[model samples]
Target: MTTYLLKSGILLFIFYLIYRLWLENEKMFLFNRIYLLASLVFSLLIPLQLISFEPSATSKIISVQLDELAIQKNSQSFKSLAESLDLTNIILAIYVTVFLVLIIRFLLNLFSLYNKVLRSEVQFVKGEKIILINEPILPHSFWNAIFINKQEFKNDRIPSELIAHEKAHLDQKHTLDILFIEFLQIIFWFNPLVILYKRAIKLNHEFLADAVVNNQFREVTKYQSLLLEIASNKTNIILASNINYLITKKRFIMMTKKESPARIFLKVCSIGIITSLLLFVFSCKDNPEESNTKKQNKIEKSSVGIEEKSTLPDEDDTVRSLAGLEIKPEFPGGIEEFYKFVGKNYQAPEEEGLKGKVYITFIVEKDGSLSDFKVLRDIGYGTGEEAVRVLKLSPNWLPGTINNKPVRTLYSLPITIQSPD
Candidate 1:
């Protein structure tokens, strides 16, 4: 889970950097909107290994895997690891707590907007339903409904430009985009990049609405003045698209600036090239069959037994953690069979009453053999050595894989020994 989050965060940072450097200031409002949305979506999907390509022959070989697996232990009853309040459990508890709080806040905001809609008077103007609320807040739109001040509607003070802006937001379905980004924020609340993404998405939405109003009215100076007037009024609704969102110098400049077709085409081509490079760097993997054949050849050449000289390259023989593999290494008949095998073969040292666990870790090699035994923790009286002896006698395991190619994975086991008591 940590590895996935790290990859996702890094991808998001890079995509956002691209936007800030090239796309953010351009006059292509619609294209910029699409780019921002696609960046967020691709940032999520690329890390999941969804779009894979064949690794190039000239590319240097690299292995991507977890550095450490969550520590687990087995006892008489095989109790869950969650029973202990370790550091991982504490961190998970905090994360879930924050997630739930954000969810509740989001629901409350939606309900508040819904309750206002239910109580307010609805009037249809030019085939669009407008909700007239008795509040001093600026105008906003939520999914197909335009909200305006009730007094302004009664006194004929609401400007057509404001109504047109809100309608543009509704017609373009900007609220759905806001909701999607809001949900992503809820999931990744700890990530600062997600916060920046929310701001970018909302700003682009305002740009789209502003473009519509400018084109409709054709009076750029008048529209800019009206935007300055509306910017003074405050909005409390976070979920709705407000008319006065971020009326900054950039928004004003974007309204009048124009780009040539050639420059636009060139920028888009550059984005494509960058995206292709990212996909190749992060998603491509070596051919599984070719990797397996090479491993076999290495094993055949090794006169020293498989126990001493591994098939992996001397310089790049890094053992991956179990959590990183697509398919986890397992004993011949799964974990229960492993327990039985250990119980049958293990000779417990002659101690009066040993009532603790012996923790052992080993590397499961590509050839389904276990090596590099390590005793992390053990009871006294040769109990740890006895556990290693039993593991060495056990049968070969099913090797783990990354991108469907076999790789060396680290495995940890804890044996519970309770003498006759």
Candidate 2:
């Protein structure tokens, strides 16, 4: 999840740079709006894509055996190698916590708006429902209802041009755009670019609405003046379409600027760059499929403690395992005899503690020796140390092979230590 968010942030930064440089002043509001939304979608989806590369038959396959390594993880020290697996869970918990907080905030805004609508006096003007609030509010549109302050409505201070501008928002269904971006913000709350995306989309909606209203008036200067007056006493709601001072200067400039078709070409070029980057990231050679389950019944032996085996790549093409081989590794007698050796030598810590499972992962070297002993998870009280102690003293077994040749294989084992019930 951390890797995914990093990739998404990088892509969003690149997309935002492209927009600022080539599309911001182009008078292409609709295209820019789609481009911004699409960039967010692509950032989220691109990291999920995967492509596999097949190795050539003659490619050099170096099966390096992991050296004798013991990783100790206990209550005092978390710097152990096993934390590589635990870090994902830690990051996921944090991400979910922030996401839920943002989701609650978003819902509260929607509820506040709904409550205001319910309390306000409502009437239809030319088949459109308008709401008059008792408090000060700059004329803004939410869905089909237009909201304005009671003073503005009673004193006829509301301009027809402003109503027409908000009507354009309703006709174009801009609220859906706001809601979509807000939803994304809830999920990717940690990402700064998601916040920028919401701002960009809102500004673009204003551009589209301004374009519609400017066309209805003979003199555009008059409408621009009215926009300035509205901005002077504006009460902007994030979820509502209202006149905003931050974006007003840009909107005024965009209203008079001539449309540029070349900017559309730039939009295409930006999308192409995004696609190329995504492909490069997703199809990278090291994107491995994860496996968490232990492989069973792979240990079988002959009288001499050497069992021949044919091996193939694992399902994810990331690791070679005993299960993927035609003939697997074994102990002197078989798997039953191997477990008997562990059962006798393995000692549970007498210290009273939680009854749980300890996960161990080790590499079966090409020389049929167990090395790289990792104490993945433990309940402490010296139990993890004891498991490592017994494994390091065990006898050598048959190694796994691929295509009738000896190859290093990885194995995972779970040793459950039960307490007296």
Candidate 3:
């Protein structure tokens, strides 16, 4: 969720900066706005693909034990060692727990808010040739079908425009959007992307609602004046922005500033954004893959393996390679148990090697078999084969998969071989 939000935030920020520049009537710079849209779509619709782990809809308490870490066969052992080396994630874990609590609390708040809105009395009033809902705020009376403070309508300064505006909110199903955005924030609380999402949705709603009210009044001047007049007041139950907030000022200015917004600019932006979105959707995205050097070495080794396909490369017939069999782990313990499986069966190569390190890359197959092992960082012929030799005798490893279906994994083993004759 954190990573997704960050990705979304970066995209949104570009869009925002571009939009802001557009607002200022200046040159616009657009980056990959599609990333933001893709992120938004994925966050709301395809969260599973975007997220690293399945986020529990309901919160769960996490237990910590430095002594007993869960391990999966054939998984990397570095995680435990790294965590033990650094205590930062311990604090992050606590933060993550608190964040979950916040999500739960926010969800409950939404339910309460929804119920309150639903239960509010609805009444319509048509008097003095105007339409308004009398919401049961205080000093209530009839304006339209909704009841609100009668004195409010009676105020000599009361512009009928505000009523139409609020009514438009109810009529256009805007509250549902607010509810949706609130839920998103709850889920992606730590993500600054959520903040950007909130802002975007709010801005869109205001733009939409403003348009609705303007269409009804027909007198653009009166509506604009009304917004400016009320720009100093307090409004309760606002989703994010207060009625009299800074954004409100921009909104009011846009409402008043009669100008033909550059259709060309909006068009160009739309084109650029759509193009970027396409790239984001189809690109070979960064989920998890080997580093460039390792990938290159793996490719080279694969080519070598193809050429040497007929030979076993060593005389150790008693040590048959387990590299080609896929072994299922009893439990998926992530990465620690993976290395434990390696450690359990692998004999550390003799220290009296030629050079600094012998790095071999190998594939752990679906049947818990290891095969196609190749030297990535080679010390020499002896150490290179030694790396493969030790790996060949490795215990049947835990099979890995992408979506619960078994898949072959390429792993690199780097060993420091000391120089001694």
Candidate 4:
């Protein structure tokens, strides 16, 4: 979800920039609207395809123990807190809480609009519903209804241009675009870009309506003049598209902007760039098959009775962790018995005044013998040395395997030492 939001935001940002820089003032209002909407949908979908061209396996297996730590500290105080607080659950709880809240808010807005419709007098004008309400508000449109003040309608005070604009909005079904972006906002409420996306789409709806009205009348100045008159009158209904001045200036500017066929190339280039970036961002996965193959070869060599072994380039070479293992190593008895062994043998470096945990790692050899014990972290006072000493004295494990053959795997543990009273 995080990756999807991130890629979506980046794409939206870039596409929005393209609109502002090259297409906003062009005579391609319909193209611009479709471009914005399509860009948003594509951004969301692009991240879901995990299409990486990279191979999964390698031949030379190198240990990656230090990349991700797997500490096994058993200090009851710290252990209880860590186990009780699951990060994934906490994040999920927060996301669901916010999502539910947004859903409730959206439902409330819809109900508010519906209640307004119920209270208003509906007049069927030329096969379309023209809803006249008692409130002193500018004309707006929602769904298939054109909302206007009852007094304005009765008094003939409503301008024909305003009715035409709202009617154009209704005819185009602009409400669907608004509702789509609204639902998207609810899902990605955490991302600020969703808010911007909602605003951009709403503004585009107005642009499309203005274009339609002007085209019908063939009078851009008169249509913009009508916009100026209704700029002061605003409506609080969230779901309705109210004719207001908040975006009227931009609408006025866009009405006068000339066509730019030449700059269409720039818009095309911007889209291409965004697509390429999204592809690179989403197509990534780790290749593990290489490491798996090397372990299998070594296991095969051992089964054939080959005593001589190939030397690693360094001590860190060939170590595989529990994550890399097809079958994890186990103590002769199970995890509980392994803990009991640690409790019996791991003495705290109390006399030396050790006061913190020491992380120790060792390789479980193909034969199940623990070897190459190393200290990953330590405090002073022989704490790390003490942990390593106890680990060296521990018995062999039931080796981890790949494809039913025992393979060398790395195991990590943390031992904490406390000060003596």
Candidate 5:
């Protein structure tokens, strides 16, 4: 999960950098909108390894190996890793708590908007439904509803241009985009790039709406003056698309700027190239030659002292990593049962208040027998040996297989031992 988040976060940063450097200032509101949304989607999906690309013949593929079975000690006999309040668990707890708070805040905002819409008077202007609230807030749009001050409407102070701007937001369904990014922000509250993405997305929305209103009215100076006036009054509801969002100098400049087709085409091509590079870096897999080389290296590294036991034929001596297997090995019942067996059977060391982990690696042979046991790390007082003893007594695992044939696969287990006070 950490690795996935890191990869996705990096992708998002790169995509956002591209937008800021190449597309942010351009007068391509629709294209920029599509690019921002698509950037978020691709940043998420690309890291999941859902899209696989064949490595080119000339491309160098790097293979990273990880433990097949990384079971944490969380059975009844021992204190669960999470219950110990380790740093990882604490961080996870904080993240989840913040995420829930953000979710609740988002719901409250939606409810407030809904409550206001229900209580205020509704009117139709130029074939659009407008919510007239008895407050001195700037005009904004949420989903299908446009919100404005009831006093402004009664005094005929709300301009048609303002109504048109909010209408553009409603017609384009900008609320959905805002809601989408809001949900993303809730999930990735820790990621700074998500904040940047929300800001960029909202700013682009303003650009899009401004372009529409300017084109409709064909009076850029008048619209800019109205935007300045609206900017003075603030809207507290973030979920709503306000007409006065980020009324910056750039927004005013983008109103009158013109972009050439060639410039847009070139920038888009650059983005495509960058995206391709990211995909190749994160999603491409090793080719057949590289796979065989990695398998050979893994077998050589794991084959240290093989016990002469009644086993499979000599031709089946090739040991493979658990990841390359078609069907991975499993404990007698399941992984959880195996953890229970280890926790129940293993005896902690007699050290006073000892707290550390024992790292053990062993190979599950083709004949479903364990062999090549190695104690990679051991705290003092025979903790590693005790872990090995418990594992040796474990029932034979269902050997991992490739193409319906059983193969030896290496497994690594780390057991945490915390002596009681």
Candidate 6:
């Protein structure tokens, strides 16, 4: 478990670096405003690595032991380990699901891009004597003569000012930005932080474009009306662009924000600091602890004494000798005997996701016969039954003694079905 956490942390750092350099290309805000991006990145990466590792056989065994300790939960420390295992599994599932979704979305976007690039029917809006080259990208509105499918503009009259707004997407190359974010979305689909980043970049794209349009186009009120006019239509797809659409009211407010440039820069820096600290702390903490000494498992003593007794106990004599009364024998004399029986009798059943835990408990009669069994931890299907069959057939045990008398006892065994490490 400790090893897994450390590995996950390392993967996350690599992922972050990958994001900042290759993905962001210094154009995005991984370093700019850190709060959302940094935190989001953390959430995203942690889940992803947690899931991707997918608990090896040893890890699954460890998890089961932890879970048993949890079930029998007497120790707070052991219980915590068990809880952590559960948490890891949950995080793993979420990360995998998210990543899968992101991959699908990426493929969808890619297909869309490929389809568009290969498309025909170029329609350029003619301005009497001025001929224009219709860009397939931005300002994809009826006003700009760039409608993909034309149910969009039957009797609608569009204002010219809105055309400048979408043109900003083109002039500033926001389509590429959109594509970049779309690509990132596919890669880090499991990370909600990346999703947030996409949204932020997208919103920022609009804001930047809005600022450009407002700065360059001199017709503010007219453009606002144009925005309202074109706002009637929005693209059906999330990645698709509508000429006049607002993602959030906040984008509108940013357009009117009165904050000085200094304050904005300070805010960005503050966010950066917090995010850097979080990533650093998270990455650093996952490393193995420094210890002055290392510990190894103490020797595993066999259930049977080191020496073997060659003489077989006489059945009736054994019953009569101990406490003067007959008792059914319990578990095979020792752990070695128990497992040897299992090895000889064991059968692997066909079942997936059965590699967690298999706990069994049975009554050991004074004569060593196991009966009335139950699965303490059943892996699945025939696994628990297989485990039971092995235990039940293990001949006689040296019946447990109570005051020089033989007695039946309940013996509990929890066998974790871990893969060979």
Best by TM-score: 5
TM values, all candidates = 0.74, 0.64, 0.60, 0.68, 0.76, 0.44
| Cα error of candidate 6 at position 81, Å | 17
For candidate 4, list the clashing residue pairs, or say none. 56-289, 57-289, 57-290, 58-290
Q: Write the per-residue lDDT of candidate 5 for residues 34-89, one digit (tens) a residue.
A: 99999999999987767666544342212223222222233344445334436667
**Candidate that beats the other on lDDT, 2 or 6, i.e. the better one:** 2
Greater-TM-score candidate between 1 and 4: 1
For model 3, how does the per-residue alpha-carbon lDDT over 1-421 read when each residue is reduced to its tens digit?
Answer: 3333444455555555554544332212122233333446643443223323322222111111112222222223434445654776786787789778977777675564455446654334453223222442321112123234444655634556665665555565555666666776665676676676566555655565566778787887777776666655554444422233344556765565554448545756675675466345433222222232334443466445544332212211101111111232322365555445544443333434333544455666777687887675554556567556766766676665544656655554545433322
Q: After aligning candidate 1 to the native by TM-score, how far in Å is the CA of 80 from where it should be?
A: 16
Clashing pairs in 5: none
lDDT of each: 0.74, 0.67, 0.47, 0.67, 0.75, 0.46
Using TM-score as the yardstick, the better of models 2 and 3 is: 2
lDDT of 4 by residue, 24-44 (tens): 667677777788888788778
Model 2, 1-421: lDDT tens digits are: 4455666788888888888886787887887888888888877776554342323333212222121122222222212223543776798899889988988888899998899889989988898889999988788888888888888888998888888988888999989989999998887787788888888888888889889988887568999888776566747787888765365677889889986567667667866876677667554443111222212122212112433231112233323211234346676687655555565677776656555656565766778898887665566787778778887887888876655876555655556665543
RMSD each, Å: 7.4, 11.3, 11.5, 9.0, 7.4, 18.3
Q: What is the lDDT of residue 41 in candidate 2?
A: 83
What is the Å distance of residue 32 in model 1 from its true position?
1.2
lDDT of 3: 0.47
Which runs in model 6 stand beyond 4 Å of their true positions?
Answer: 1-119, 123-138, 141-160, 171-173, 180-196, 286-421
